[model samples]
Target: MSETKISKLFTELNQLKWSVVSKGVIVGLFAGFVVALYRLGIEFATEKSIEIYEFLKHNQEYIIVWIVVIVVVGLLIAWLIKCSPESKGSGIPQVEGVVLMGMKMRSFFIIPVRFIAGILSAFFGVSLGREGPSIQIGACGGDIIASKLSHNKLEENYLITAGASAGLAAAFNAPLSGIIFALEEIHRSFSPNILLAATTAALTADVVSKTIFGLKPVLSYVDIPALPLSQYGWLLLLGILTGVVGALVNKFVLVSSKVYDVLPAWSRPMVALLLALPFGLFLPQVLGGGQNLVQLSETAQMTVGVLFVVFIAKLFFTTSSFGSGIPGGIFMPILSMGAIVGSIFAQTLSGFGIPASSIAILCICSMAGVMAGSVKAPITSILLMAEMTGSLVHLLPVAAVAFIALLTSDLLGIHPIYEVLLERLVDKDHVNKKHDNIVLEIVVEMGSDVAGKKVSEVNWPTGTLIAGIRRGQKEYVPNGDFIIYHGDYLIVLSSEHELETMNTCLNKLCRKN
Candidate 1:
């Protein structure tokens, strides 16, 4: 109660916080190993898949073989989901559930399965992004560490945040952006503890990934130049246009998902197959990561019509793949689509006699603008774009467009895709539930004897009983007889003193379970 006493208490608390962060650094280093290997596997699969595609392109005899390969990849994805439902979509929403809603789901099997399956799907020409799955997988590593290394709830959460940041950093070789992403998007909070854990994780992940793959930016040699002062007007115009397109894309994706659901479950794959064939035949540039299109735009070689067609095709495929509930991500597709559209906008100016250098600058800004509009993370998008392209020269134009595009998108009622996806992942009825005052969140770990036990068998401490369980999409109001499963989120409610005793009892029960 005295000033000296308060100061001593504060010092002890600070020491405790740093100790947790030190443990986080160890967890992050461990998680980085998984992330580095995961990225390596993706690159290897991508290389082999391209080789097969080249072989099929030249050999008429191999055309049927290509069809078989494509069909097999589709069936494999369908089968993986059919068997283990957790491997669906970008793993972002699931990770968010684990952190925010007390949903328990482990990555022990799911992460590796996703790495193999996602790489296969992408390599075999299934339209997807590698980063989203990789990030989710990386976060799983953190979740694993959190559960294994500590029974402290705060410590576990910090580790989870760290692991997720490491995964993103490893995937893109952008350590700073990954840390920002964990703070801005994943944790949705900023504190000294969270910052320390996330920084350690991201920095560690990048170091590991770079050691394995070399310290190169994901997209190479993008000569982003500064636009003339007069060109600022066009950049603003580009941002407004991107806002409209982003809104439209969101609409189409939501509609497509609804339509896909209306179809019979078995019939969904056939629809995706049909969509892929036509797009594959006519616009191969829009296929895969669309890295080629990005390269073309940087070189200022794509014509306006070509860029427009690529944009349309990319949008359609992205809608089809994501809407049909394919196990993939939109990060790359959305960014690539925006880049193509931006290229066309810049090309239009070139036709109007805008200088070539100015057009290039505008093109880069347009990419950042649309990505900011679509994701609704303007600062993150700008930093990611600048990092990805390895250029800070266009920061002013990028900022101008990103601000306008983000503002316009908000006016049109657009939400970030991950936020929207999380909402959709939760059942509508659950959203309407009012949990205004009652809840307790706890993280479970491997060594906790509770790791493999049922709720009914474990004796809870006095004044505490499990009220509900949330594992991934599933939630339950537990009866006294229910069992607690691993990665199962136990929602317990109690008073301050009861909670304290309950926490100690839970820890002891965890030791014995």
Candidate 2:
């Protein structure tokens, strides 16, 4: 073809935008329905758990029967996890393993096991949320579909990311948050290729979810007045408090996991289920994912003292409930804790003439603040709270709180919770597979060792090759003299044997040492 015709052809592929949108829609269709169903399953199971607890509270004679049932369910969950070890704890790290680390996940096994395991865990009143499992399921769904449809592994990874965004979108009915979380937390970069697919998938999933659940905000905080400018100082204080407490919660979860390390993996869930029995009967308010507690605080049903006690109980329960390698998420539990803390803070300062109108606003922002601190995805957290509240009215204050909280967590030397979990997973189950040639996309982060370096200056792995560099809407085949900027997406080629080592080396170079 002539140069003009070739240029036209390249222009048609502008940013490769259309290439991924259809794939994203397909992944979204699969993930949206699946995760929405997963959400429904958890909701139904949790309601049944509440009913069972109410019965146990009244009829002491049947407590033993309920206990037996718990043991059986626990064993079932354990067996389900054994069927696929990838179904364990939150599943976000597993997705990261597949997408970022060039690892593998079996969607056929993971989807079904995670669905059943998540439902069972919720059924018995485990304090875990459905969000993490949902994301994993969605990601697997994307991977399975992409494997059949895409021509390359990189495309499959992009679709996998799209599925993850869809999963979170459907779970919380927050599409923008879903997209942002996939980019910020899961992939840790915002390449245009990723942005294109992730946005499509998240929006599509949100549409399907809304079709099922209706047009209401996940949590009803309508007409809640924003905090006044004079109250901005309180937001800074709230950020510090939640930042410190969220980091502590993250540490507590790791410690709890360590404590459970003494037990065989299968037996760990049994202990967590047994712990649930007491809470099921006595403190049902803090039971399950603690969604009711969030609702209560939103409606002002709980007092400062009551919120404090319940917060303590839920905090301890969540660590054990999640730490035992159960199939659930920290998203809701952490948000609830933040809501409770915000409520307590607002109430404590109520005597000082802070208006009650600001109570719900603070509660909402604090949810974002806590998640931002713990997850290390400040932008995603802010957008998540905004989407969940179904308004942008609180974005300014919420952004303030989330940023401060993230800053606080960083100063304390606490890494993101998912990053830590991914490291532990690597140490425990590092599986190396055999592939003839595999392509992975690694994004150059800002402040990385290689950010300002030229291609010739950086030391690459022996077998690794930089296939191409993607910068925004443009793509270029680099010569050694080309300068690689931060935010560039690199297409790399390697085999299975060297995948792990190359990944480690590249990450070291692409991240701040």
Best by lDDT: 2
Span of 10 residues, lowest total lDDT, candidate 2:
6-15
So what's the TM-score on candidate 1?
A: 0.79
Query: Candidate 1 — which residues are off by over 4 angstroms?
Result: 1-16, 264-274, 428-513
Clashes of 1: 6
Candidate 2 lDDT over residue span 1-513, tens digit each: 344643553454453567789899999999999998999999999999999989988999998987788788889899988888888999999898887777778889998898888888888899999999999999998998888888766678889999999999999899998999998988876677789999999999999999999989777675888779988888889999889878988999999999999899778898999999899889998877877777788667888888888999999999999999889999899999999988898888988867888888989888888888899899988998888787788999999999999999999999999999999988988433435456667788899988989999998888878767778878777789999999887777777788878877887888766
Backbone collisions counted per model: 6, 0
Give each model a TM-score.
Answer: 0.79, 0.94
What is the per-residue lDDT of model 1 for residues 443-504, given as tens digits with 9 covering 90 to 100?
45456766666666666677775655656555566665666655565656655444434644
> What ranges in model 2 sit over 4 Å off?
1-16, 430-436, 472-474
| lDDT score, candidate 2, position 441 | 71
C-alpha displacement of 481 in model 1, angstroms?
A: 42
Q: Using TM-score as the measure, which candidate wins?
A: 2
Question: Which pairs clash in the backbone of model 1?
Answer: 104-487, 147-445, 449-513, 454-484, 455-483, 455-484
lDDT of 1 at 408: 87
TM-score of 2: 0.94
